[model samples]
Target chain A: MGSITLRAVSKTFGSTTVLRDINLVIQEGEFVVVVGPSGCGKSTLLRIVAGLERATSGHTLLDDRPIDNMPPYHRNIGMVFQNYALYPHMTVYDNLAFGMSAHKVPKKEIQTRIGQVAELLELQTLLRAKPSTLSGGQRQRVAVGRALVRQPHAFLMDEPLSNLDALLRERMRVELRRLHERLRIPTLYVTHDQTEAMTLADKLAVMRAGEVLQVGTPKTVYQQPATVFVAKFLGSPPMNLVRVESRTRGAMNPVGGAEEAVAMPAWIQEGWEDATDENGTIWCGFRPESVMKRRGPGGLEIPITVEAVETLGPRCHVHGSWGGQPITLTAEDGAMWTRGAVMRVAVPWDQVHWFHGRTERRIEPRPARLETLETGGAG
Target chain B: MSNRLSRLVPATAETPVRSAKPSHPEKHWRLPTDWREMLIGYGLILPSFWVFLVFYYGPAFFLFYIAFFHWNIFASQSQFVGLHNFAILFHQPVFWLSLFNTAYYVVLVVPVTTLLALALALLLRESAGLRGGGVTRALVFLPHVTPVVATSIIWVWIFNPNFGLANALLRVLHLPALNWLASTHWALPSVMIYTVWHSVGLYTVLFLAGLATIPRHVLEAAQMDGARGWLAFRRILWPLMGPITFFVVILVSINTMQTFSQIYTLTGGPHGGAGGPAFATTTDSLLIYQTAFLYLHFSLASAMSVVLFGLILALTLVQKLIADRFVFYR
Candidate 1:
């Protein structure tokens, strides 16, 4: 019954617009993660949905009822803040019981609910301790317990796990996922960490500069990013994007001084053939993992001089220059290469992403050519 | 063969032996390590420490010693009269009356001033950066910095029964004019009003500082938890401000107890005999001054001083004990 729909939501602070035309929907039991760089308005979006902030335009509906005009408390949404925000003066038991007491739940029912939540969150033994006495992870569990005890229609979390150490963050991530599955409340979690977005989200919304660049399943966004921004933002060391000028119809020359020409894959050329620009320029993007050492190449081969190598146990990132543009390629540890060594790297034609130079919008490859490219390449 | 013979000799026997008596090296007299630095540190604070000891503690100890004796400024010698001054003070109705008046003044001033300051702080905190905020704060704080004697003189004029601003305003509202500082019934109240106006601004600034320390996210979280406005203040803001409230209570209590300048300026000087109109406004401090300087009962005044000091100390300790039960340090 907890479904949230946002329509044409925008927020402006004075003259500066913090969010624009934000349209999204979360089905019952869905977990949506909104992610962006710092100051991309992800936190503001959560606040607006929580009714802590007012949107300049548009409506937010929870369970098919308009809640934009409602106060934060009346909106029936629970929020876990980035800092936990537990009342320092109150014991953990009281912290969890505060909202229930304020809403005038029966005293007997409050006790029962608190007992159940404490058992569920494994916080029974620490119920009398103040928040100052609890460990960071323990405090986090208490914060989640506080939110869960209310049994709100939905939950809004603003970087709840960002305060933990890396190992604890990973463990909490799994626990949160399990908690979501068990409770099935529609939750909107916001974080700057892409790993959290990818792992915890049933649907991921990537935002940049006050607008959602793309929203899709993590797998879809990862494999087929809709924009150069999304492609560059979602991956570690990021995807390698090269600027090129389209020469004639099927070939492209690097925009810089390098004299190398790369033949556009038949599928990419076919996708853009009908909508060819007069200047014939485009931006090409591919993930670091997609580029491999040339192995009896039929795919496009680009020669690169290695500038640096970062060995990360099982895999190493090879930082080098390709056609005067800096590119990073992730290779297995067995692909050992030293600095200043020239190596030929092959990009699977099907894996290459094409975007218009000016607008940076994805151009869908022709279906038949894409199928051939996928089958012809080794998986 | 020679090398083998040399190796066969015992090592200890070949070594040189010292005399049975051990020699003691000359002990040089030197300061301990870091002594110079400690000296320098003490040297830096010695002036202020000396002033406090000489001016404050010196008089306090003298007063305590003289309270047990019949001491007079004109007499050549003081006679030791153990507990005689205290015994006389206990039997006097004027002493009890002054003590009660002082307690009344404290009761009126502390809570009213603290609450008013907290309310003003809450209202002004949100508008701190707006157009009129700085000007308003400065105006409110002006009386605190102004000379008490000067402001009390202005208040005397304002409290004038005939043409003063207070009476004029009352007349505009169609109320009868009444005596302020001149009447026995209104004297203490008039002094309390002036003291509150002069002291509230300082507490207001203190409360504002305390309010700023409360993290914004905590309040937002409270609002999200279905606690708004008064509920949020009661549950979150008030509890979080416990330490500051305790501090403000102690400070205002002490300040009100020791108030002298306003009383002196408002009720006329010692020639007019401090607590005028049948001692209606006589607080402990004013009574102590009038008894010793005006009536030449120095020993009795010293005894009253000791009692007043004890009362202030007991009150502060009791407040601290109570605060420990409720105020959250963190």
Candidate 2:
């Protein structure tokens, strides 16, 4: 019943367009994380839904009813701000009961609801303590409790865990996920931390420069990013994108070095023969994990000069240059590689993603293969 | 290895070659050697301290001393009169009337000025985001910076019963023209109105500063909680402003009690002495000034001064206690 739909929502402050043509739907019990860099208008989009901001264009709906002109209170949406925004003057119980009293709920009902929420949030011991007396995590729990006690239609969290320390932030993320699972309310959470977005979101929307670049399940977005930005933004070490130009009909060379040119894997040539741009060039992207240590038969291989290695307990990152392009690969057995060692690294052909060099959009694998390329395979 | 270890250890077997003990390493509570530094620090403040001692504390002590003697400024010799000034003040109708007038003025001015200033501050705070807010603030604050005597004279002219702006407005409204400063019933109120006009600006600025210290997100959170307009003010803003309200009340109380310049200018000339038209505007300050300067009753004036000082101190203490009970400090 708490479904929220935003259609072509745009916001312009003076002449600068902060949010442009944002369209998203959050279903009941769905957790959508809007992940973006700072100033990406993610917060503005959330505010528009919460009615704290008015969209320059388009409509926002709550449960099939238009709420564009509705005030925040009338819309019955609970929001958790970045700083927690707890009333410093009020105790934890008062903070939790504030919203219900504002809505003129009955005294007995408010008491029962506060008791229930406090018990659920483990805030029974802190009911009489003011916000200043609570620690960061405890204050954050009280803020969430305040929103929960309201029993609003939906929740909008604006980087609710950003102020917490790293360890507490991790713990709170799990608690937030558990809370959402228990409550089953449609939630739109905004954050710049990719790990939080990937882990917490049922659906992830990657935003950049005031535009939603891609929205999909975390697995889909991680495995098949629609654009180079999404691929670069989502991963920790990020995707390694190397510019490659077709040398002949079937051979391609990583840019800046001709000695590294090799025959394009037969599967790729067969899969995207017609998908190459007019210049026969494309930007190739692959995850660090896709860079295999051992060369597989029929796979594309590149010799990498290892520069440095970072050992992270069980796994490590091998940093090096492949065909003069900087690349990092996660290696499970990184102890075998040493500085300045030249090793043959193979690229699994199926895991490689190709983008048109000019448009920067993913190129679909086509079934067609050029007959001239088969004839000119000798080159 | 045992022989080497024995050599490395300075054996206590050598009968402990003891060094001479230093003489008296500790002295009990020696004076600070940096006495020159202390002298310089005290030297820096000595001038102001001397002024305070001679002018403030000295006069306060003298006021107490001379209150017990029948003294006049022009008298060659003063007579010792124990409790005589107090006895005369107790029986003096004019002194009682002056005390009542002062209380009346304080009761009228403190609340009116504080509330007016707070209201103005709220209005100005709402417009603070607008372009003309600074100019409006400066305009309101202009009267505060103006000389009190000058503004009070202007107020006297405005309160003139004949051909005055106030009576002119009343006449335009078809109401009978009433005497303002000249009428006994209206004289104290007229002075109070002038005092509020002169002083509301400063307190408004104070309240504005207080309002600014309230975080924006807290108020926004209140609005999100469905508290708007008067509800927001009553529940959130008022409680948050408790400390500033207390401060303004104390300041206005002290300022109103010491109000002599305005009453002197408004009613001193051609009205009736300093008390004016049958002692209507005679506050403690004005009465003290009249008793000493006009009537040459120095001992009685000193007694009144001591009483006023005690009253101010007691009232201030009371206000502080009340403030401590209610004001929430973050």
Candidate 3:
């Protein structure tokens, strides 16, 4: 078990920076996943940690020992790649034994360690089978077993489940969680999948455009995203960002929303004065589930026309337009909504967020239900 | 009367005849007119087929047919000797000696060339994507695309006796460079050196292609497992290089057996040259040429051709049989 810390690490390929100022710590026995879009340098950061790619400038320390100069083997790092990368010619037994043999471990101990790992991965029955004959899932298990036999400092995984189908990916995600808990080794996993990050990571570093935008627990990052990019990136049917302009403190017109005018609540209005500019550009960001389906206290009912509806068993996505700008809200039932039907879109004042005109940082007016953010606000 | 019965009697009586008629329309049953265009397409390929029939199969069967008969350009009459030509070939000591020599050459060269090629390939593949890789590759490949005739001539000059640059360098270095081509002991080994040198480039490229297919992550994983250099090469690299080795072995064997041009150019056999004051430099092809064309012993030459063919076929089959044991497609 080890802790990995990167201090001011940055990597550049040619003129373009692949990663910038990436300072993160993976605590001992903690599983941290770095999540981002492709080209966002998530995998590059992982490679840097694995010693496969060197950082252009930075200090990376494992257990307080600088490992940036160490070769991969010398660093005692084990990496699980997206492709299993199992030696095709070797049987599962030899695949597990390869590292031990390379290190010149005794033959008897090699056999014993391989036997232990095979049993741990439940790969004993597959020990004699060649990699070519194994299914994708089994190959993945073998890859994990190969990593496990080394008992390295930490396991660095790069979207290791991306090759598996949906069902297997899910199964493997659970397997990985169980394995992490059982081993209690510090792990740094890289993935672009948000749900995987949410479920598997104790900490998430949300990266975008070569910079990490936010880093926190999954709940903290999702609930209080540091920037619009993080908020929009983390949620599916992503958070809706409606641009609004500040006019006379609280009252502002929606940017390019239909001519229908609406006023910000008195609390939202004060927050807007400090948060937004008079120039036509502040955005109100809200999640799909946060939008109210019915009129309630602290809600503003605005006119919206129903254009389309997608029924998913427990909840249906009601896709429509508000003031002629497209809006989608998750409705929790199958309601009879005719084509071109106009209805009230009640947005609870407490749930709506205000942001700066240029910078998309969330501006708070002390919403009633967010106890955590409120307490965090005190801090 | 039967036709009348077909109509007047129960219609079921003609059921078998009715079943025999075309079920679908005859126009549909015939292939489309597009077939005429297809035939025209195939007509375009006829020239290549004609070339193969004339140049490939033509010589193939003709060589065997001539092997059973004796023909001499200087003689007034060509005679059919049947198996007697073969009998005369079996009695020659040079026949067995040359066969033994050629097999020795193959044994010495093939394994060395294959191992060298694999090592060069691993080196080249590692340098892939690195700066200066293109220049490195070009340098490695220069000897291959260099005209073999020019290179062989260069080797001949380098192996020259007495006043030649080869022995002069040996004197300067205090190492004996035996007059290479002039010494019976050095000639065969010298030729193999040239052969191995030329063969390395082609096999190296083949191995490079094989190595490129090995996933980069696999190498990294091996590295993480503490496997590097020779251990990695032995465990991962060599086993996966099986297919390339198999291909190189077969190709080298075939080329070694058919190596006439270089040997002919270098030694010119005992009749044309001294053959190093012994017959050490004479290859099987050289002996056959001398017997059939030099001495008018066409029967003996014909018999030698059959033996050479047999040797080539046997080696090729043995390579295939051995290859099936180690080559892993996956």
Q: State the DockQ of every prediction.
A: 0.57, 0.37, 0.56
Q: lDDT of candidate 2?
A: 0.86
Model 3, position A10: C-alpha lDDT score: 98
Each prediction's TM-score versus the true structure: 0.89, 0.87, 0.89
**Across residues B1-330, which tens digit of lDDT does each residue of candidate 3 receive?**
363245444554555764677576655454443675466557868999899999998966766766777766667776777887778777888777777777777788888888888778878987888999989887887788877667777888877886777788889999976968777788888788888787788888888887878788888888888788888888987788788788888887788776765676666533476233377856677677777776877667767877888988898898888889877777
Worst-scoring 10-residue span by lDDT in model 3 chain B? B268-277
Q: In model 1, what lDDT does residue A121 have?
A: 83
- Stretches > 4 Å off in candidate 1: A246-249, A257-259, A266-281, A295-298, A335-338, A366-379, B1-33, B74-76, B126-131, B171-176
Q: Higher-lDDT candidate among 1 and 3?
A: 1
Please write out the lDDT profile of model 1 over residues B268-319, one tens digit for every residue. 8645756876788889999898888778898999999999999999999999
Worst 10 residues of 2 chain B by lDDT: B12-21
Q: Spell out the clash pairs found in candidate 3.
A: none
Per-model TM-score of chain B: 0.88, 0.86, 0.81
Residue range A139-193, candidate 2, lDDT tens digits? 9999888878889899889999999999999999999999998999999999999
Estimate the TM-score for candidate 3. 0.89
- Residue B309 alpha-carbon offset, candidate 3, angstroms: 2.2
Worst 10 residues of 1 chain B by lDDT: B12-21
The prediction achieving the highest DockQ against the true structure is: 1
Full candidate order by TM-score, most accurate first: 1, 3, 2
